[model samples]
Target: MSKVYILMGVSGVGKTTLGMMLAEELSVPFYDADNFHSASNKEKMQNGIPLTDLDREGWLGKMSSLIPEWQSSNGGVLACSALKEKYRNQLAGGIDKDLEWIFLFEDFSIIADRISKRKLHFFNPDLLKSQYDTLEPPDYGIHIKVENSPEESLKEILQKLNMPEFGIIGLGVMGKSLALNMAGKNFLVSVYNRREGELEENIAQNFVDKYSDKYQLQGFDDLKNFVFSLKSPKKILLMIKAGDPIDEIIEELIPFLKTGDLILDGGNSHFKDTERRLEKLSELGIHFLGVGISGGEDGALNGPSIMPGGSKEGYNRVKDLLGSIAAKDRLERPCCNYIGPGSSGHYVKMVHNGIEYGEMQLIAEFYYFMRYFQDRSPEAISKVFTEWNLKQISFLLEITADILLKKENNQYLLDKVLDIAGQKGTGGWTTVAALEVGVSLDTITASVFARNISAFKKHKNQVRELYKLKNKADLEITDDELFKSYRSASVINHSIGFELLRIASVEYGWNLNFSEIARIWTNGCIIRSSFMEKLSGIYDSTKSSHLLLYPDIAEKLNEDQEIFTRIIPAILSQGCPMQVCSSALNYFLSFTRENTPANLIQAQRDYFGAHTYERIDKPRGEYFHSNWKPE
Candidate 1:
C-alpha cells in the first residue's frame, strides 16, 4: 500500500508552501485541496463568507477519491484544511492506506499577519478567525511550529519517523562499544542485554550512566520492551556469542519482530550458520545480515573495520549508518561495505584471523631468535623491536614492542607469562579451507601446529630432562640482516594467505576485492600495517594470482631471499624452533621451483595401488598403470 502525507492547518499557516516542499523532498506527488473546491464554495470564500461544513462536503469527497488514486502510484503529499476532527476522519476513514498527518501550527496573530499580506489567494484575511474557531488540533499526528526553516522541519519529521535508528541486543564489550559508537555519531540507539543477575544489570546501568549524558542512548533489560522502543522497519544488532546462543536469542526476538525488520549478527559466527539463519529469517520477511567486526576493545571503542553481508536490501538500509560509525582511511573513506551475499563477510574475517595467526607466530619467532641466538635481554629486544617498528609499521609489531617493554616486580612481564597460546578456531578453519580448496597455507598451518605443540607441557618437560636438550647461544646476526629476513618471511606468509582468499573467492563466487580487503585492514584491525597500504597499492596496480608473483613484491623477495636462507638454518642449528619462518621459506622455494620429485610419488602410487599416472611424453589426463612389480 502507498503512503499519504497530509499537511493540515488553518488557512494562511503556509500549508501549501510546506506541503509542496515536503512533496519534492520526499519525491511524492503534491495535491492542494483548494484546487478541488467547487465554484460556489470558492465564490463564498472569495466574498468573505466563512465555509460551512456543508460547503466542504464536495471538496472533501473529491480529496477522498484523489487520495487513493495518488496512493495507488507512489503516494502523495496534500495541503488540506482538515481543520475539524470529522473532516480528518472522513479523509482517513475512506482509504486503506498509510496516512501521516502533519499539523503546521502557529500563533493566531502570526498567521493573521501573513493572511493580511496575501494578494491573489481566494480566501480573505477576515476568514482566518473562522478557520481557527473551526480548527480541531490532532492529538496523534506530528506537530511542528511554523517557527523553523523548511530544512529543519523536514529533518525533524524524518527523525520522528525513524527514532532509535539502531537497536543493539547485547551489552558485552563489543555490543557496548558499538552502541556508544553509534550514539557518538548522533544516532539514537536502544541497547538491550539479557539480565540474569545483578552483575548484568549493573553493567547495563553503568553504561547508561556513563554515556547517556553525552549521547542519545537508552538501555533496556526487557526484550519485549526493547523491541518496542525501536521504530518501524527495525534494525537490531546481536553481539552475543555465536552458534546456539544466537539461535536462542533469535527465537526469543521473533515474537516481537514484524515483517520487514532486520536482524544483524555481529559475532564471529560460522558462515554455514549464517546461511541457515538467512534462509529461515527470510521466510518471515525479516532480513539477516552476518557482520564481521574486527579490532579488539580499543577498536570497538574508537572505530573498527566493519564487514557486513547478507541481504542487499538490508545493507542498503543500514549502509549510511554503518559508514558513519566505521573507521576511515587516510583519504577518510569508511572501512565498511556490503561484502557479498550470505556469509562472505564472516568468511573474510576467518581468513583475516588466520593471517593474524601467521603474523603473530612470525613475530614470536623473531623475538625468540633475538633472545636465545643473540643473547639479548628483554629490554634489549624491546629497543630493537621499537627501532624496527619505525621502518616497518604494523599493529602487531607495535604491540609486541610494548609487551617486551612491560615489567612487573622487577621482571619482564612477557617472560613470566605462559608459553601456551589459546586459539578460537579461525586458524583451524583457515587450514581446513586451504585443504578443501587445494591451496597451500603452510605458514599459517605451521603456526596452528606450533600452538598445539606448546600445549604439550608435561611431555615436553619430560623429553627435555631425558635428553638434556639445551638451546645454543653462540649464533649471531646483525640487526639489519635479521630485520630483512623477518620482513621477507612475513611477506611470504601473507602471500599464501592472499592466495587462499583468491582461490576461495572463485570457489565461493563472491568476487571478493583483494585491494578493498587490504585497504580496510590498514587501520582499526589486528593485522593493520603500513604494509597493508602498500599491498593495496600492489593489488590495485597489478592483478596477480599470488602476492609473491607480483612484480614489486617479487623484486623485494629477490633482494631479501639470501638473508632468509642464512637465518633459517642458523636458527635451527641453535635448536630454537622457527616453524612459521621455516614453513614460509619452504613454501616460497616450492612455489618458485619449476620441477619437483612428486613424479616419483605418482609412479609409486601407480605400482602399489594401481592408481593411474600420466607419462611425461603424453598429453595430460591420459592415465596409465605401472606393472613394475610384475616385471
Candidate 2:
C-alpha cells in the first residue's frame, strides 16, 4: 500500500501546501479531503467558525474511508486535520489506514501569521484560534518538526516514510503519454505492458528518458508476476476495448485479485456492462467502476468527463488517488462524483445516446426539409443549421451543427446520406422501456422507425414504381398551409415523445428531474437545447400529469400550427406509425370530453368490479349495475 499520510492541523496551518510537497517528495498524489466536505461543512468553515465534533464526525468519516484505496495501490498523502481521537477513530474504522500518521503540526501564532498573508479563499483566518483550541495532539508515529522551514519538514517526513514508487499499466502511445503527464505533474510512474516493445516506447517518449530510474516496465506474462510489479490492492485501470476483451482479461485476472483490489473500467463501456461487472466483481469482493471516459483519447490522457459508477465504498478507496486529475463540474466540484448503483453511470450514458438519437433526428429532419423541400443547397442548409446553434439548444445539438458543417470525404456528406439512420441498443431500449411502462416514446420511436425505413431500398423502389396515384392535396398546398400544418403536427409529435419520457420516469422511480437532466444535456449527451431547459423547468412549477398542458410549451407547439400540421398528413400519407406522438396529442385534446375511452374503460372496470356503470346525465352521483345480464 502507498504511504498513508494526513496533514493534520487547523485551516491556516498550511495543510494544502505541506501535503502537496510531502506527497511530491514521496512521488505520490495528494487528495485534499477537505475538498470532499459537504455543503454544510463548507458553509460552516466559510463562516469563520470551527465545526463542532458532532458536525465534523460524519464528514471526517467520509474523507477518511476515501484514502484507503489510493493507499491500497501506490499510496498517496491526504490532508485532513485528524485533530480529535473520535475524528481519527472514525477515519481509522472507515479508511482502514494502518494507524500511520505523519501529523503536520505548527504553532497557533505561526498558523495565524501564515493564514493572514494568503489571499482570500474558502477557509477563514478569523477561525485560527478555534482550530488550535480544538486540536488534539495525536497519539502518533513520525511527527514532522514544522518548527523549521516547510521544505525541511517535508524532507524529514519523506525520509521517515522511505517512499518507493512504481509506474502504470501499458506503455504504448496512451500509456506512455499518461506516464509523461503524471511525471510532468512530478509523479514517478511505473509503466507496464504485455510486451517489451511497449516499455521501450515509453522510455523513449519520456523526454531524454529521464525517468529511466523510476520507470519499472515489466511484461504482464504471469498474473502474480504482473501483480508484484505494482503495489498493494493493485490499482489496474483496464483501458482496453469495452465488451469481450475486457471480460476475458478480467476472467484471467480474477484469480489474482485481492479482496480490496480495485479495477477501474476507464473505457467506452455501456452502463449495463458496468452494472454486470460490478455485480460479478462484488461477489469476489473486488471493486470495479464503469468510468465513462469522455474527451476521447486526448481527454483520457489529459482530462475527461469521468462518470464513475460503483459502490461508494470503492470510490472512497481510490478518492485520494484521483485528486485534480478528475474533471470539474459547474460548481467547481469533481466530475468524479458517484453516479448511482453498478450500472447507473452506463445507464445515464444509454439515456445520453437515446436523447442523442432524438436530437439528431430533429436536426436531420430540419436538414432534409432545407435541402430538398425548401430547395437549399448543402452549403445553404449547413449555414442555416449552424445559425440555429446560436439559440439556447444544448451542447449536444450545437456540436451536431458542427458535425453537419464539417465536409466528410469531400462531400457535404450529410446530403449524400440516405434517409435512414443507424442505431445501437440504446434507442431501442428507450422505446422498449416506454412500451413496458406504458409510456409513449414518440420522438425516440419515430427516430427508430426512420432508421428502419432507411433500409427500404426495395420498398422505396416499389413505392416509386407503383406511384400511379398522385397526392392531389400535396400538389395543391400553399406555403402558408404547408408551414402552419407541418409545424403544429411536429409539435404534437414532440409533445407525445416528452409525455412518454415523463411517464416512464415516474413509473420507473427515477425521480426524473427534467430540469436537471436538461441542464446536464445543455453541455452533454444530445437534444441539449434551451428548449429542453424550458422543458426541464416545466414540471417544476406544476404537477400536471400531462406535459401537453404546460402553457408555455403548448404555446410553442400550438402558436404555429402551420408547420407541424404537415407532419400529420405526411405521416398519414406515408403509412408511418404515429401512435406515440398522435395518440398523446389526441389524449390531451380528448381530456375535455365527458365520455372518454378511459371513462368507458372505467365503466368496464365497474362492470367487472361490481358489475356497475355510471349514467351520462345523472342527477345523483351513484353507480348502477348493468341491467343486461348474461344469458
Candidate 3:
C-alpha cells in the first residue's frame, strides 16, 4: 500500500510545497525535479527561459521509469512539472505502469508572483510565462485548483482520491448496477464494457450521469481494449456470456492484464468449464473467477447473489466491492463469498440449482398430491400450501406457495395449469458435475430426472404399446395423515438434498462454509429462508462437520422420524415419489448413529473384492474379513 503523490503542474505552482508536506506526513522518501534536472535545462531556466516539451522528454521518461521501484518498495511524492499529456502518458508506461498522477493548478499570474518571492533557484520568475504556455492541463488525473497552499491540496487529494478497497470492471446491466451500488457509498469504481453501443445506456442506468466524468465508462471494442480501460493494479471482471465467448474475452485480455488481474465469469457457466478454464489461466499468471449470479434479469439489473472463486489473490483485489453490491441474506451477510479456488464458485451454484431442483420437485409433488389424491379445489390446496409456508421456510418455497394461492385475474391459475415443468441446462450440469466430483446426488438427480421423465411425451405415448400403467385410483388417505406425510417427506428431501452438496464440498477442494453459504442464499439465491438463517447459526459451533450433523436439524429429524415412518406408506399410496426421500433420510439417521453403512460395505467389496464387517464390541476396530457367518 505505497502512496506516491506524483505532483504535476507548471513550475511556479505549489507542487514542490505539497510534495514536501506530503512526504513529511507520510514519513517516506521524497524527490524533487529541480535536483534531478540536467545542467542544460537548469542553465536555460536560470537564463529566464522555460524548458520545451522536447527538452523535458528525457527527464519525464526517467521519472516514469524510476517511480515503479518506489511504488513497489518505498513510496513518497515526486515533484515534476508533467506539463503535457504526452509526458504524463510516458510516465504511465513500463514499470511505472500503475502510477497515479496528481496535478496542482494555480493561475499563471498567481504562480509568477510566488516564484518572484522564492530564494535562489534555477527556475527564474521570467520563465513562468513559458511554463504556463507549455502546460496543457492533465484531464485524467487529480486537479487541485483551490488556493496555492500545498498542504490544502494534499489534504483534499488524500480525502478524495483514496478510494474504497476495490472496484468494478464491466458496466453492463450486472456490472453497472454493481458499480452504482458501490459508488453510491463513494467506493472507487472503474468500469469497462463494449465500445459500440450502450455507453449512454450505462450512464443513464447507473445514474452516473450525475457525476458523469467520475464514473467513467472506458469504451472498448474487444477484451484487450477492455483490459486497457481498467486502472493499473487491475481487477477486471467478465460480466459477459460464458462458453466460447468467455474464453475469447480472456484470451485477448490476458497478455495485457497483469498476473493479479481478475476476470470474473458472472454467467451460468458449467462448473467443469470453470475448473478447466481456471487451471489453464493460472498457468499464464492470470486469475480466472467463475462467479455464479442468481436472481433473474431484475436481479442482474439490481441486486443478485454473487458466488466468486478462483485465485485467492484476485479475490483479495475486490471482495469488499463485491460484498457491498450483493444482496444480503438472512444473516444480514451479503450474498457474495469466495466459493473456493478455480471453478468452485460455479460448482457451488450448480449444486445450488441441484437443491433448487429438489425443492421445486417437492413443491410440484405437493401440488400434484393436492390435485390428484386429495381431490381438493385449487383454492383449498393453495390455502393449505400458504399456511404451511407461514412457518420457517425458504423464500423460494414460500413464494411458490404464495403463487399457488394467488388468484390470477380472478381465477385460480393452479387449476388451469399444465402438469409439465420446463428445466434449463443446470439439471444436466448438476448431474454431470456430481458424477465427476463423486458426490451422491440421488435426491437432486432424482428431482432432475423426474423433470426429464416429464418431458417424455412421445415415450409416454409409446407406453400404450406395453402394459398399461395403472392410475392410483384405489388409494385413500385422510387429510390429517396426508398433510403430516407431505411435511415430513419434504424435510427428508431437504436433508438428502443438503447431503449431496456436503459431499460435493468434501470431494472437491471447495471449502463450502455452511453458515456463509446459507446467509448468501437468504435473499438473492434460490434456497433462502429462516431455515438457512438458523442453519447458519448452528454451523457456527460445528462448522467442521457436514450440514446433516447440525445439532438442531438432527434433533428435528429425530423428533419427526416416527411421523416420517407412519407417513411413508401414505405418501406412496398417494403416488408421490417418496422412495428417494425415504432412502436419504434413512441413510442419514443410520450413518450419523454409526459408521458401518451398507453402501460403504458395498464400496469395500467393489474396491478390494472383499466383504468386511465390524464387530459389536469393537466398532472402529479391524473389519471381520474372515469365513462365512454361522446361521
Give each model's whole-structure lDDT: 0.85, 0.59, 0.67
Q: Report the CA-based lDDT of candidate 1 relative to the real structure.
A: 0.85
Best of the two (1, 2) by TM-score: 1
Q: Give TM per candidate.
A: 0.77, 0.58, 0.65
Write model 2 residue lDDT over 1-631, tens digit each, in one string: 5557777766666678888987787788888877778888888888976788777777877766666666677777778887776777787775443435667777777778888888867788887777677778763345565787778777777665543233355444555555554555444344444434655443333432455565423334344565545544556766666688779778877887777677877655765577788889999888887755444345445644455567666666556445345444455544345554565555555555555565556556555544545456766655655555554334544565666676778877666766655776677876775677686566667767777777777687688777664322233334444334423434444455555556755654444444444344332323434565565567562344566677885676566544444454564454334433453345445642566576678666766676566677885677787644567
* Best-matching candidate per lDDT: 1
In every candidate, how many clashes are there?
A: 0, 31, 1
- Across 1-631, the per-residue lDDT of candidate 1 in tens digits comes to 5789998999977789888888898898899988998999999999999888888877888788778777789998999989998999787754423677788889999899988888989998888888888898875456778877777877776666555767998788899888888888878899888887776775655778888679888778888888877766789999998889999999999998877789999999887789899999999989899998899878887889988889988887788788888888889998888888888888888888889999999999989888876778988988888888898898898899889888899888887898899788889988998999899999999999999998988787679778854565565678988899889988988888889988988888878888988888888889988899998888852354778878999999999988889878787877788999999989988989999888999988887899999988999989998687754
Over 4 Å off, model 3:
1-225, 405-423, 435-438, 461-494, 497-511, 541-543, 577-631
- Ten residues in sequence with the least summed lDDT for candidate 2: 470-479
How many clashes would you count in candidate 3?
A: 1
| lDDT (10s digit) by residue, model 3, range 199-259 | 4444432444555666543333354544444444556666666688777766666678665
Q: What is the lDDT of residue 127 in candidate 3?
A: 73
- Once superposed on the true structure, which residue ranges of model 1 sit more than 4 Å away at CA? 1-162, 541-544
